[model samples]
Target: MSDRALIPLLSAIALTAIIAACLVGSTTMSPGRLLAAMVGAGGAGDAIVLWEIRLPRAIAAFVVGAALGLCGAALQGLLRNPLAEPGVLGVSACASLGATLALFYGAAALSPIAVPVAAISGALAATALLAFAAIHTSSVITLILIGFGLSSFAGALMALLLNLAPNPFTLSDLISWTLGSVANRSFDDILLAAPFMIVGLVFIVLSRRALSALSLGEEAAHGLGVDLPRARGFVILGTGLVTGAAVSIAGAIGFIGIMAPHLVRPLVGYDPARTLAPSAILGGVILVLADIGVRLIPSPAELRLGVVAALIGAPAFVWIAIGRGRTHG
Candidate 1:
């Protein structure tokens, strides 16, 4: 389908996903009951489930997916590499590390907010560092390498923290946060992350035209009046904020950001700017569906959302990589 047509379709699908998410869970509620609850005529229990639990979780899933997808689309466009994701910048790793620290130090035991706050702080710190580096060099390859190195370092640190974990409980908490999930995510989680996500999205959107120019090559983009360094700063900071806030609550969800854009790119003819919104919509839908899948699974213990994403995404990544190799060859 044409992008103009596909965009609306994606939006509608996203809406459907949100609706489905609200309705599908371990405990079933018929559509009639849900609708009655929505109109305030159902039992109080239905209202609590619909309004307090399902709706907030669905909305949170939608927004988190969209933000991460936006970052992935922007990054791929800027890097001119189809495989790039927010993780490429090490923001997710840093956020994970931050949460690990909170778990390690027992800060999370004191309050529910500690882990998310630390994760956001870690992500923003990485963004600032990357932004400063961007000022020194305008080479995209250098930036990617730097991000890779940072990610590796953060991963190592996280491993060290895990090794030194004081007890099994701390170890479990660390593992859980690193694995990622959207279950039990309340409205407060959405509210806490929304501001940062919005600002991050605005930054990416601001860089959209530059991203399009960049597809023509850096020199061409520069000649076309794109301030390459500032644009890089915008993407790094924007992606960092979005990814960081997401990791705070969801705990390092993966693949949705990458898969979302790739799924929508063809419909938009691979134009980076044109791909963003639809990609975001698809990302949200994909995550909500994934969350719903975890809920409906008959396993004694539910799978983490990130685990499901990796199972689905890693092979797809390789497939895309191999396909791109053949296409270029």
Candidate 2:
């Protein structure tokens, strides 16, 4: 098969292996027993560990990773910014701050839906404000400046909430969650995030054709019959919602949005339509593997997935920056 075709197949196999490894590594069970538990043949202890614990984290990693990937692609395509990312642009921070507030004020503690709902609202609000700032600015640099401003504001608010939390445990939990982890995610968390992700996915998928048009530049896209304003709105809405759900569950896992899409874009021969799906798959694979790697590398104490990704991505970013400098120079 060609390189384009090989990627999806490889990604699928890699994801399966990582998932299997996670299941096996989470406890002392052999692969055979893990498979048995997965297939409902094992006993209650197997069921509890495999299903109740490992399964949820695995699924969360996949779903949240997919959302992050899709959002990254959409935001990059919409803004035509290689560095545009939900977390980096600060939308995820806004969502986290909103969720933190809800939890701190006992709104989410009192109602099951409050955290995600509040988070989605906050994400949408931030996007809207950013959009408004972008509209008046007349330049991409201005847009980036506005995005940075919004992100900074949201981050500051999150810090304030951390200071005001009622107890040290609450503060620690919120802080750690903001640092991002898929450990001990529940069915409720899945349900809460699913709708936003699904809806966002639909909009993102719909924008594939528009994204292709967009790659040629907005004026050219409009000249070619793409509805620029409508497409922009759709992309913004999709990114915001997907980002919100991801933050609500996984906290602010940065760079996956920018890193995943950019890495995969060249593999698809720069076809934006093909880029989105493959990026999503690779994104899921990346996060799952990162989570599993963190678990395996340190053994008992469990390293954070975000830290692992950052370590890898930080070097990758440096390499990319150096390459770009050489190319331009």
Candidate 3:
């Protein structure tokens, strides 16, 4: 489909997904009741359930997914690699490490703001290191290897924190955060992360033209008047802000970034520039649906959102890897 047509289709799908998500929680409500609750015409209990519980959770899921999707598309374009993702590149790991440290020391108890700040710090550190490496070497293979090393190191640190947990409750909280979820999130959490997400998204949008030029290779892009350094700066900063803020709020949800863009690329004629918005919308849809699915599945307890995403994403990752290997081979 053309960009114009594809955009409306994606928007409609996103709207449908959001509405479905709002309706399908542990305490299910009909569409009429949901609308009534939204507009303050429903009972007090229903209002609290819909407004305070489901609405915030659904919105958080969408925001987190949109951030990841946009970052993934931008990173794929910037790195010119299909496998590029926040998790694959260790950015999410680094942010998780930061959040883990805060939780480990009980900073979260002291202040809700501490975790996100620390996460952002870790993300910026990782992105800066990656930017430095990119300047010194242009090999995608090298970058991927470096990312793997960083992820491994961060994982080790997380393990250490877990081993030294002061109590079972702290340990459990740490585990849950690492696993990721949007349940029980409040509007305050959304308010905290929105500014960073907005800034990151704006940076990505501003660099769309440059990202398109980048698909043609560095030298060719330079010849086409693309300022490689500035473009890279925007992408790195944008990715750091979005990914870090997302990790802070939702823990380390993975694969939506990689999956969303890949799903939408063909619809947008494979144009990197056109892929960003669609990927974001689809990402929101995917996460909202996943959140709803977790609620509906029969279990002793609801599944972690991150775990569900990983279960679905890991197979997709392997399939993509195999296909790419075949294409290259």
Candidate 4:
């Protein structure tokens, strides 16, 4: 389908997913009641449930998912690698490491803002390292290897922190946070992350044309007057902001960044620039649906959103790897 046609369809699907998410919690709510509650016309109890709990949680899912999707598309286009993702690139891992440090040292307890700020700092640091590595080498394989090293290092750091936890409670909290979820998130979390997400998204959007030029090859992109360094800066900064902010609140949700772009690429005719919006929308849809499924599944305790995402994402990652291997072979 054309981009024009697909936008409406994707928007409709995203809206439907959001509405479904709002209605599928433990206390099932009808659409009319949900709407009335949102508009402040429902019963006090329903109003609280709808406005205070479900609404914020659902919005968080959408926003985080959108950030992941956009970052994934931007990275894929920037690196020209199908396997590039925040988690795979160690960006999310680094962010997790930063948050883990905050939690371990009790900085997070001191202030709600500390964790997110630390996470964003880690993400930006990782992105800067990646960009620096890219500057010295044009090889995709080298960049991927660097990302692998970064991810491994971050993972090791987190594991060390877990081993040194002062108590089992701290260990459990760290583990749960790394497992990722938007459950019980408030508008406060959303408000905290929104500015970073928005700024990062704008940076990515501004580089669309540059991404399109780079898709043709560096020499050609240069010939077409694309400032390669500036483009890289935008992508790196944007990815850091979006991925870091997302990890701060959501705690390392994976694969949406990788999977969302791939899912919508064909729909957008495989144009890198065109893939951004659809990927973001589809990412939001996927997360909202996943969050709803986590709630609906029969369990004494709700499933973590990150676990659900990894369950789905891991298989997809394997499939993509296999497909790429076959194509290359």
lDDT of 2 by residue, 291-312 (tens): 7787778556677777777777
Model 4: per-residue Cα lDDT over 68-100, one tens digit each: 988989988988777888877889989888888
Candidate 1 lDDT by residue in tens digits, 148-236:
88789988898788788888887877788778788788898888777778888888889988988988988899999999888888877
lDDT of each: 0.82, 0.77, 0.87, 0.89
TM-score of each: 0.90, 0.91, 0.96, 0.95
Model 3, which residues run further than 4 Å from truth? Answer: 109-111
Give candidate 3's root-mean-square deviation (CA, Å).
Answer: 1.4
The digit string of per-residue lDDT tens for model 3 on 111-189 reads 8788888887788788878878877888877987888888899888988888889899888877877788999999999
Off by over 4 Å in 1: 106-117, 125-149
Best-matching candidate per TM-score: 3
Scored against the true structure, residue 153 in model 2 reaches a CA lDDT of 89
Model 4 spans > 4 angstroms off: none
TM-score of decoy 1: 0.90
Write the candidate numbers in order of decreasing TM-score: 3, 4, 2, 1
How many pairs of residues collide in each model?
Answer: 0, 0, 0, 0
- Candidate 4 lDDT at 247 equals 91
Which pairs of residues collide in candidate 1?
none
Q: After superposition, how far is residue 93 of candidate 3 from its true place, in Å?
A: 1.0
Name the weakest run of 10 consecutive residues (lDDT summed) in model 2: 17-26
Clashing pairs in 2: none
